[model samples]
Structure formats: C-alpha cells, structure tokens
Target: MLDIRRLHMLKTVAARGSITAAAQSLALSAGAVSQQLAALRHDVGVDLLRPDGRTVALTEAGRVLLEHADRILAAMEEAECAVAAVKGTVGATATLAALPSTVARIVAPALTALGTDHPQLAVTCLVTDQAQLRELTLGTVDVVLGQRYHHVPETMPKGIAVSPLLDDPLLVVTAADGSDERSFGLRELATHHLVVPPATTDCGQAILHACRQAGFTPTTRYVTADIAAQLALARSGLATALVPRTAIDPATPGISAAPIEDHPIQRLLFAATRRTETTNPTTAAVIAALGTAARQDHTTYLPPA
Candidate 1:
C-alpha cells in the first residue's frame, strides 16, 4: 500500500507552492522533503514537481492528486471526529497556542488553576511565533490564543468562534541609565540597532511597520526564535527591543520600560474555538479560565508602545 505520509507531501507541496516552504511548514530538511517527493512520484507514477531555479513548482497532475488527497484527509478527520464523539467525556484533551507574553503571565496561571481543580483535562501548550491556524486546520489543538496587533481586526476567521480576551501592552525596554542612550522619537528609534523577533512574526512586523510609519526603518542587530531571549538581549544592552509588558516583570530592575512616544502598540488576545463544536464543555471551561486570567494579569502588564 502507498504511504499516507507521501500523500501529505503532495498536499504540503500544493499548499505551499515552493518545496522550500513545504519543508519549513513540516519542519523537515530540504533533502527530507525531496526524498518524500521522490517516494510520492514513485507511488503516483508521474513527475509531480520540477526544479525552477531555487524552488520546485508542482505540475498539473500534482494539483489533481492534491485535490483528491484533501478529500481523503477531510474524511479521515470526520472519522476521527466520530470516534472522539463516541469516546466523549467531560474532559478529554486540549492544545493551546499562545505568545510567550501570554504564556508566562496569564496562561500559566489559568493552567495552574485548571490543573489544581480539573486534573482530568490534558492541556498542552505550543508557544512560539504565530501558527494559530495549525490548531484549527490540522485538528492538532482544540483552542488557540491569537495576538491582534495594530488596528484591531473587524472580523475573525470563518470557522472559529472568537471571544475577545484582553489587550497586551507593547513597550520599549532599555537600560535605566541614560549614559548609553536617551529617549528618542520614531525616526531615531527606527535607526537604532534593535533586537527583533522572527522575520515573519507579528511582533517583528508590528515593530517594523510602527517604525516605518514613525519615519525610519529598524536595523535589526539580532533576531531571536524565542521571546524569552529578549531579556538577555536587553540586559546586555546590545540592542533596544519592543516587548510585551507582561514579559518584563515591572518590579525587576536594571531596565526602564517607557511607553513608545507617540506610537501606541497593544496586542489583543482572542480565545478561538471551532464553531462546529459550539457547546464543547471542555472548550467552555478553557475559555472561562482564559477570561479570568486576562482580567487579572499575574505579571505586570504594560501599556501600549
């Protein structure tokens, strides 16, 4: 029998036009993706992709196979749903996606509360750069806490039921002593060598656009894969950074966090659940916990940038 994993390769390649993107999506090396595609070609008896300079593009036959694969995946999901329904209990399993700021401050508290009171529920948190859609699309998780930056969005994704949580303040953090640096407006702020988040991350984009609007572009001296690294960067004074208020425990000294002059930056955290499971009790409990946590940020919450 042909491998289900190879079909996933075809689907991944289809979703992300380039093989490089597919590899990143699956967290696989380029060579690994190439091997999988080779297996996929052997199974299907056709040339599914071609090398076009740096990237691979899928052929017409590849696209056709992808459509069928999508149906198969959806049906498999439906079957899983049926099984899950039959095995239903008040508490099953839930996965959560959150930014590090929320994870440290609010999410941790809520999870603690849940664990103390409701131990039966299995909760796993995947905290990193935004990949909220993964929870909903792949059925990897039952809930997601997505960050909303800049002008608030008027709408949410179609299939998800959204509940607005709270606003997270993004602030500029630097050494307290003015000897090395002094407060500056947007233009100067942009040029300052900054410690940045990942390239495609929302926090990274927020800092970039806010700087551009204020008039200059940020020269990122360093970028971190994890939010926790920002503190060390700030401690060393190697680069200035914009971080969530909660991340910086206000009581912790050596750093002065100032609201970004003239530029307002806040993140709106939202609790998202699949609309199809409107009355999931476990989801309801999770939302309640999140609401309680948001109302009272255990960690010192900052004002907008």
Candidate 2:
C-alpha cells in the first residue's frame, strides 16, 4: 500500500527543489531525506527527478504527483475543520492524564461528576507529570490535569487552552502521636530524622531549600520518591516527611500533617485543551465540569511562598 507520509515527503522534496535543502527545511537527517525520496520514486513506479549537476529537478511525473498530493492534503484539512464543528451527542471517548496523586484526589471526583451527567462520554485516566502533560497539548490526549510546584517556572504551553482547576497545599508531616508540641521551630525539626523525597523531584528540593534557610541541613534517613511511602515512614516513627495535605488517609492513620510555620507550599493545577474548537465533545464537557469543581474547591487557600 502507498504510504501517505511518504507522499507528503515526496511533495515536500519537489517543492524545495534539492534534497539537501529539503533535509534542512524539514529538520530531517540528509540520509533520511535521500531514503524517503528513493521510496517515493519506487511507490509511484516512476522516475520522479532528474540530476542537474549538483542539484536535482523534478521530471513531469514528479510535478503531477506533487499537484495531487497538495490537493489531497488540502481536502483533508478542510474535512477535519468541517467535522470538528459537530456536537458529539451520540458517543465519544475522552482521555485525561494527570499526576498519580492528582488523579486520585482531584481528577477522580471531576470524572465522577462527568460520568453521572454525560453518559455518552467514556473517560480514561493516565498517570503523568507536568512535562508529560505539556506533550498532550498537541491533541494526543483530550484533557490533562497538571500539577506544578511554586518555584518551578510559571510557563503554559503556547497554542493550547488552559483553566486553573485547584490549589493543593504541600505540608510538613510528622508522627501525630510522638510530638507533644503542636508546632515546632526550625531548631526542633533539625534534630529529627527526615525521609526526604529524591533530590531530583520538586517536593524534595523544596524541603531541602527550607532546611537551608533554617540554618541547618536535614539528616535524611531515606531517599524515596513515593510520597505515600514517605508518609508511612513518618507515621511509623522511622522519619518525618513533607507531603501534600490531601495525601493523608485514615487507612494509614499513623501520620499527621501540620502546616509549616515558616514555609507554606501551594501547587498550581491546570486543565488543558488542545484547541478551543476541538472535535471532541467529551473534552468540552469535562472542561466545563472542571471549571465548576475548581470554583467549588475554593474552600481554603494556602498562602503563597
């Protein structure tokens, strides 16, 4: 079967005139350009180009192929635009990607509300972080719930639409049973065992920065990335950890979260759409519900750092 991508490549090469120029224009390796051109010639069963000293010029067959390719692609683009305007009342699929923590706490509730209201929409949740979430802005996934720390660069991907969904508090957690004092100063925490998040992660780095500001380094007992495991350690008297306040579950009833007196961390959450006029109706409905959930979620706001 003829490949559409190879046809597009042939069309591009013909328009650009030279293979070297086409490679540069397309940001593809010179070898890849040469291979695709050879494949395109074989696929069409014709000699498509003529060598003219250093540069190559398209023969009659190549010109004909280029014309056809351009017409086909333009027709496809028009079809996409036309169909995208239709409302998806019949049946549609929507995929939502979010961090593991956010998927459990925030996305689950929003998805529940959507499922109850819009029975035609099927929702699938994928666990991912901000970097992965940014990639889905290309329309790979219908909606993305991204979690970002305070100090991380305040950047939203261009060409994608976004809505702020929730603001979650990152807390300093310890054993509720062991500490008689409700609150502790910087000096008191320096003496305890800390199970810090991996130094590479945002949560771990934030806790490290707070300790440095307090004029001491935390003695880390374990280097772990899972906030749940860190919370478990803190509850079992193995170590104290910094975790999101919403992460505390009664099933793991040992750990207790207390807001830091010195530094309070708040995470920004955003819901994204590939484009405002996307074809997916389920995505549109989810976006509307998320806006409602975000406004209702405004029960308490943690102070920013």
Candidate 3:
C-alpha cells in the first residue's frame, strides 16, 4: 500500500514544481522530501519525477498519481473531520492566506478574538495575494481572504466555497492638499501621473479597466506590486494612485484620499475554503469569527453613509 504521508509530499512537490520549494513550504529539509519521494516511487513501482535543469518536473506517471493523491488526501481530511465532529471539539491548526492590506483590518482582529473565544483552535496566517490561488486549492492553506474587483471578476475554481465578507471601495490617494476629500471625475484622473499596482494584478487591472470605460488611459509612470510603495510615491507628490480604503494609512503625513466620482471602483472581499472542508468544526468557527471581525471593521473604519 502507498504511504499516505509520502503521497502528500508528492502532491506538495507537484504543486510547488520543485523539491526545494516544497521542502521550504512544508518546513522539511530537501533531503527528507527527496527520500520520501524515492520511497513513494518504490512503492508505486513507477518513475514519478525527473530532473528538469535546476528544478524537478512531474512525469506522466507522476501526474496521474498526483491526481489520485488529491482525492486520497481529501478523503483522509474528511475522515479526520468526521472524528472531530463526533468529539464535539474544534481543536486543530487552520492556516489562512490573505493579501497584506486586508490582514491588518480583518485578519489581525480575528486572530485575537479567536484566541479568547476558542482557545483550542489555533489559526496561522500567511500573507499572499491572488497569484497564490492555486495554493488555496491544493490544501496548502485551510482558507484564503481574497478580493474581486467589479471590473475584473475572478473565476473561482471548482470545489472551492466563498463567503462574502465586505465591500472595499477603491479611493484615489494624492499629495496632501492636492485634491479635496470629495469624489473626482475620471477625466480629471487622466491628467495626473499615476503610480499603480502592476497591471497583472487584479487590483491594477480593475483600475485600468475603469479608466478605459471612462474613455481615457491613465499615464502610468510607476508600477509596483506593493501598496505601500504606491502610496509612498503619491505622498511625495511624485504620482497619484488608486488604492483600496483598507490599504490607506490615515496617519500618513502627506497624502489625502477621495472616492472617484463617475466611475466608482470597488472590490469585494471574501473568505474561501475547500468545499469539502467547510463541514470541519474548526473551519466553521474560524469563518464565523472572520465575519464578526469584518462587520466590526466596517462599522469602525468606513465613513457613514
């Protein structure tokens, strides 16, 4: 019989595309992962992987086994969830991945609240973005806090469940005293030198699409993947940026934010989990806590209508 643990290692390896990367993500030494892969190959009597330049690539047999591994591992997780349900306890480590900006508003408070409310359930937070959606589907994380722009909707993969959390409106951040705290028209934004997140990201694409819809392309002078970097450029009077309200630092000394007037760009924030793991008591508890925290944040931080 194939070892379940080795099968899991193989799955992680395939997802990561390299033994070293899988080892780092799993907190195992590369040698340990290699040894497990070798044992798995012996048990299955097949060549599962082959060296590809500096990294490793999965073979046809490896791809087939990896598919089976997903089902087997999911079955094992369901079995554990079943046992935990019978015990009527929610005690296990649940890992959550989210974007950097969203973490401060919702995730941090949820962590504190979960500790007080359910001492037995431990939650680990990982900072990631939409680029890591595959990690969420592969079971690298128990849940993910992701955002979807109205202009650039994301297609959730099969077997994943999403819980709507909050609506984060995109705001314009400019040099202090440059624009009043009122909505500015998209035509006005076209005249400004913009510093935006890389267009490859969902947030960036949303901004570009919204601007185009208004009949002008923004003159993007700088592109960064970091929100803070975008804000810093805006604060220095070097560029203007469209940022999610959650990403704005009200205390920052030299920047002011305003909503876009005609083209209102907003992103929907949600928590995602594997469809099969939703029934796990620990997962349910954490999801509930996230909702509570998100509601609290909206009330405390968002401007009243």
Q: Best candidate, TM-score-wise?
A: 3
Select the stronger candidate by lDDT from 1 and 3.
3
Clashing residue pairs for model 3? none
What is the alpha-carbon lDDT of model 2 when measured against the actual structure? 0.68
Worst 10 residues of 1 by lDDT: 296-305
- In model 2, which runs have C-alpha deviations exceeding 4 angstroms? 1-91, 129-131, 178-188, 250-252, 277-281, 291-305
Alpha carbon deviation, residue 175, candidate 1 (Å): 1.1
- Residue 163 alpha-carbon offset, candidate 1, angstroms: 2.0
lDDT tens digits, residue span 208-281, model 1? 77877887778888898555577667767777778887676766656767666677677778888766432666
* RMSD of each candidate relative to the true structure: 6.1, 9.0, 2.7
Q: For model 3, how does the per-residue alpha-carbon lDDT over 189-266 read when each residue is reduced to its tens digit? A: 889999988888888888889989999999999999788898889889899988898776566778888888888999
Model 3 TM-score is: 0.88
Alpha-carbon lDDT of model 3: 0.84
Model 1 clash number: 1
